[model samples]
Target: MTEVLTKRKTLLEARDLHVQFASRGRKARAVDGVNLAVGEGEIVALVGESGCGKTTLARTLLGLERPTSGQVLYGGAGLDYGSRALKAYRREVQLVLQDPTGSLNPRHTVYEAVAEGPRIHGLANEEEIVRDALSRAGLRPPERFFLRYPHELSGGQRQRVVIAGALALAPRLLVADEPVASLDASVRGEILALLLRLREELGLSALVVTHDLGLAWNIADRVAVMYLGRIVESGPVEQVLTAPRHPYTQALLSVLPESPEPVVLTGEPPDPTRVPGGCRFHPRCQVLGVGRAAEVGVDGKCKGEPLAVLPAVPEPQVACHYAAATGS
Candidate 1:
């Protein structure tokens, strides 16, 4: 992982990022103190369960949501929020949302859909750019699909069009939120393959946000396990997925089809509007009051003292008292 970092340039980064919202007169910390990065032409997967703030983090990174504090950087420069600056920044950073059906306009033809970005950015050679993007997105014979509307295409084709739209802009990084969650089993692999091929052919970098660890294993160069509103564990895909140090990550992986001993977590994650003082995961953490944590005598701290935010580094990092105590 360190070698990969040294070899490639860091394209996009988040520093102590926090996104808060006013909910029922309380602050909901959707993205709390997250530090992450994606290198040039690298794929990083942000995996977590639903409502774990992965989507919010993705939005914040795309500049859709303003952070309460902290900053997002691109090419080592802080993001500018002014309308013109944001518009220019968006051209370099595009988002491929979860649902293709919703992302596309049923009234718009495939050509219009793919041409939207180039048009908005006032780029020339519209026809050529659209064709190139479509072909690159695996929709060969691009002219055949140009006149087709969203309702006229198959699920996989619609997704390809979505990818083409992002590709049309020639973005430096793609922040994909649940990129394949809406596709059928057979089609999911196709999109994943397209993303990989794009990275190889175009040197495109991606931040893939999904809950599927298997997806991460298949496509990601690195994996970040998010819980509640923070990244609890992250490292190289081979390291973190194979030997997860955080209990939350362990619990998540145990439910996969191949696990011999599954770990079942009780209760729901606490509300972000009222996060617990100690470890935010303490109430539902299986390792806190029993097993190794109790033996290591950090059980009390687990319920009363918050763990420091995990730093973004090349090596594996886990934010759990038990993990820190045992040095695993």
Candidate 2:
């Protein structure tokens, strides 16, 4: 198991951040008071199923989505997403979207695409910057691909071009939202390797959002498991993945091809807008499966605990009320 270094500076942080949207006349808190951080020279994966708000959290952390409440801090200072400041912050922290097809413009050549950020920032030596960025992104002899359009490249190549564009800006952090989810299995490793390589060579931090546990295992130093907009468990990759404390995390693992004692979740995840009282997961919780309004402890606390986001805890935070009993 790979272990993350203990002492590292935090590059970005989300302090109890919440991103809510009004959908179908009900409020949906896509990012429900998430508290997370990406340390310098470290890689963290936000792992969860679809609609768990991983992307929304990434957008908010990058200052692309305004939080309904709470704060996003860069180096411990609050972010001001005003046009000029946001633009400057953008140059320091870039984003790689999930879809290369939608992200890259068909009309733009690889050179043009890579050059756009430097041009927008009015940086000198656009040619050197574009070439170096592409080279760093593994398009060796970058000149060879300069004139090609998005359609002319393979899916992996197109994704690399997008990554190169981000690298052109010379960002310290990369918020990659499912960077390789669309590619063939063969190409996924290549892109993941590039990210780790960038971290080693350039001292870059990354917050990779994806549903693939294997991807997290492959690259991240830490893993944060999200369920219905809140992180239920977070810790070192090996600790979280190998010995998950949260019931949901256990449930997710049970279905894995190599999982030995998989815990199957009953019923679909609850609706975000209409989240249940007490524990949002109580309805589908295996701990409560014996019977609804089940009693636990002398006070029967499990029957009714207020439904609020879990507070910050020690490493490997688990939100389940019965995490201690169930995990053991």
Candidate 3:
């Protein structure tokens, strides 16, 4: 097993990040003015509904996709994207993609697939490095599994191989984007346990991106809730999950399918392109309560003023005009 490192600075940071894509002759902001950080050995979860840009933000962090503006800082310096920095960044921050089979090449055996990274980077000899990576990823007794192809392994094993490939680079931060989504529910728990144990053993920080609040509840130290390219709320795991301040956050938690129904924040979320003025959530917010905007400082039916990301009661930050009104 790889010995976990001790005493390291912030592993990754993304500040004022924006990601835009041209769609229908118009620029669509996938990630809009986001800021986040991951400590040396802490796990932060990016939670949101689908199409909220969580995946895009993760991709931006990994340099798989470039942000339109803002900066992603790693180890105190801006990610350069120059040859040296790119190479270093790729090694230090790796992504465990959602799809195991899709991410792995069918033609390559497990040994070839896992060894590819070290070979491309000229970091180590193939045979020794492949064995080490497979072992590290818990394909224990590595020699027995090295020659198998993606098709030969079960979904869980294939995913482990994918993780092995990423670990071959000895990354300090692992960006897991729904890494267990495709697995069966029982297997999902096992994978989560494996990931958590890996963090403890390797001292790795993780940015786990997922739309499932349940999954976030299982593994996250902190949760940042995003809605339509903006962070609606964020804080420690228990606080944010149990006492959500933003209506959107509340809505997300209410529909979790767990027993003991939470207070449901009514109304559908507003469309991204045509977001309402001031508080974006006011359109569907039950707390808006007919001409109560002025009380919360939202003027004229949520048109009163620009929205503010306010610090709510209990250590959480919620971006909602009525966070104080909600007794959050």
List candidate 2 segments past 4 Å from native.
1-5, 290-300, 307-314, 325-327
Q: Candidates ranked by lDDT, best first?
A: 1, 2, 3
Instruction: Please identify which of the two predictions, 2 or 3, would achieve the higher lDDT against the true structure.
Output: 2
lDDT of 2 by residue, 286-321 (tens): 767755234544124454665456543326667766
**Residue 113 in candidate 1, Cα distance off native in Å:** 0.6
Q: What C-alpha lDDT, on a 0 to 100 scale, does residue 64 get in candidate 2?
A: 84
Question: What digit string (tens of lDDT, one per residue) describes model 3 on residues 1-328?
Answer: 0122223356788888888888777667788778777778877889988888899899889988888998899988888888887887888899999899899999999988998889888985678878887887879899999899999999999989999999888889999999898998877887798889889999889999998888899998778998877787887788788877777777778777783676555566545555556766676675675555566665453554556533211246777766655565
For each candidate, give its TM-score against the true structure.
0.98, 0.93, 0.89
lDDT tens per residue, model 1, 6-67: 58788999999999999999999988899998999999999999988999999999999999
CA lDDT for candidate 2: 0.85
Cα displacement (angstroms), candidate 3, residue 182, comes to: 0.6
| Superposition TM-score, candidate 1 onto the true structure | 0.98
CA lDDT of every candidate: 0.91, 0.85, 0.80
Select the stronger candidate by TM-score from 1 and 2: 1
Question: In lDDT terms, how accurate is model 3?
Answer: 0.80
Give the lowest summed-lDDT range of ten residues in model 1.
285-294
